[model samples]
Target chain A: MSDTTILDQDRDAGFGDYFALLKPRVMSLVVFTAFVGLLVAPGAINPFVGLCAILFIAVGGGASGALNMWWDADIDAKMRRTVKRPIPAGKIEPGEALGLGIALTGFSVIMLFLATNWVAGALLAFTIFFYVVIYTMWLKRWTPQNIVIGGAAGAFPPMIGWAAVTGDIALESILMFALTFAWTPPHFWSLALFVKSDYKDADVPMLTVTHGRRVTRNHILVYTFALAAVAIGLGLTSIGGPAYMAVAVVMNLWFIKGAIDIWRRTDADSEADSHLVERKFFKFSLLYLFVHFGMLLVETSLTPFGLGGWS
Target chain B: MTQIRATHEIHGRRLSRNIGLGIVLVAFVGIVYGLTIAKVGTDPNDDLGAPWAQAQDKAAK
Candidate 1:
């Protein structure tokens, strides 16, 4: 179905093009969240082991990206936003991406099992499977709420990280997972609102393209409310402290206000401003997740010095 | 001109292939180092430390 040619390209594909298939931006989030999860747990990991766990987790996340690109090459070639991706741009073949993704997936999972524990390794494998199979192949093109269900894949990193330390999952890690899960819908929906055309042109079943902007906006607000609940609740947990609570309260307030503002705007208003508010909301959503996770890292690092995590 | 073009293409493919192989090699070494050569924490609860500490306690006895 993909029109992007695998051969006879005018120019040779470079190393960077292949690297781009790993979706470094998404991998960074996986790395950071997984690192926070590992560090904030109640035990000390060898520094090298912890670093290795994070690295493997990032690789697992990247493997998922490459597999996703391989499968979605057809839609990617059509969508304005994704047309520049390596596979879609004819820089790399679809089969090559699939092979690389599978290789990394196996490598990361097996090595993580050896370096850390089976629980973390299993979680990483499941994350890759869910993203590639459940999200990329099945739900993405078929459901308007693709991201809502697919969000679980992105939410598993911190849990995997936590498991890496304790060799088990617990309430604290689940709460961290919940934080990301609940945040996903609103973040992606806001982007979908602004870029509905891309989804429509690609024939993707994004909420905005299928249900219209009004419905998408309402869903964003609803999910934002849910996200705020999770974000604020996380602060009350043992791993979270006064510092986290402070960050959470401010960020959630601002986030909810942004969602509400988006909910009220007419499409005409959006168009007049060139989707400025929608764009700002989308950008803020990125910062929102980063700040929350960054606070967790800060709290964890400060704990040894008598300054973090619930006094 | 065709010969020159073909050689350039061969060189490009070789470069890309080598880089790909290099990445795989690096990833393999990193994983091996982390798995075999690396140590966890010094606490008894830490994975590597626990076994070694038990051994030391036995030898001391």
Candidate 2:
């Protein structure tokens, strides 16, 4: 075979390549949040049905990832962070990604409806639409607030999970959704502070690129305060307990300190340390969300033992 | 005569894809079966004490 053929063969898409189109890391967040949502809601679902609900919600989330990859392949190739995604890396055809995304969207929605209820199925469908159309196609390139609003797409899983069991929405689930929604802006803006050039080069209007890092830092600080309010407020809801309240208080304090550290620093300080505070804040944000949700799960587990929830 | 090798790079990818697809298909079948059993066993109409069915009966009356 010629050298060209050899190179082509080496680059041929594998099963893993197609799986990567689903953006598994992001899907993991979807799975976790949705699981917490289902379990914490005030209803009993069969363990198997609960598992299916989480699985289908994850699949729906992954379908949106695939669709996002398909729609954003152009700008994805421009960013160091996303350049190696399946489509941008040439491992999968755009049409293939589109087809897989559409196919999974349908299958997941229908299966979730069958296994759970129409509420969850409808929420999943709307999430796919929001991520693909509203976020990817419209807001991403057009506004600095892209992630601010686009965060809704990621925040829906818990609500969908709650709906799966209860077949309705409630304040507790809405609080869960609000916790993630409020968390997104700071979580993303912190990363954008460090990787500023990626969005600039891609011509995407990220807060860091559009408003400058100072403003981005300020936004992160403000949003972190809002997030703290949401987090603390969630602890007052039906799902909150002693454990969750403690976790919320401690994590929010730490998060606020990190945000303040980022806010107080000038570009000189950040550049001197290679954005250490920003990067640290970003890393802590991940743990922050996980601990909060994990505590909620803990509260639910303790409920049967009469230790969980406000009641 | 030129021999075609079974262990070519592209062939390996194809094989992995096939195996991955097989696992997913099997898992899907298992999930569907489990879901069916769960749905049927917990069906509100099948259980006299199910609050949901009682609520529905009350609403109908």
| RMSD per model, one decimal | 4.5, 4.3
- Fold similarity of candidate 2's chain A to the true chain A, as a TM-score: 0.95
Residues A98-170, candidate 2: write the lDDT tens digits. Answer: 9999999999999999998999999999999999999999888999999987898999999999999999989
Best by DockQ: 2
Share of native C-alpha contacts between chains A and B (below 8 angstroms) recovered by candidate 2: 0.73
The alpha-carbon RMSD over the true interface for every model, in angstroms, is: 2.9, 1.5
* Residue B57, model 2, lDDT: 79
A166-210 per-residue lDDT for model 1 (tens digits): 999988999999999999999988887777467777777877767
Candidate 2 — which pairs collide? none
Query: Candidate 2, overall lDDT?
Result: 0.91
Q: How does residue A129 of candidate 2 score in lDDT?
A: 96
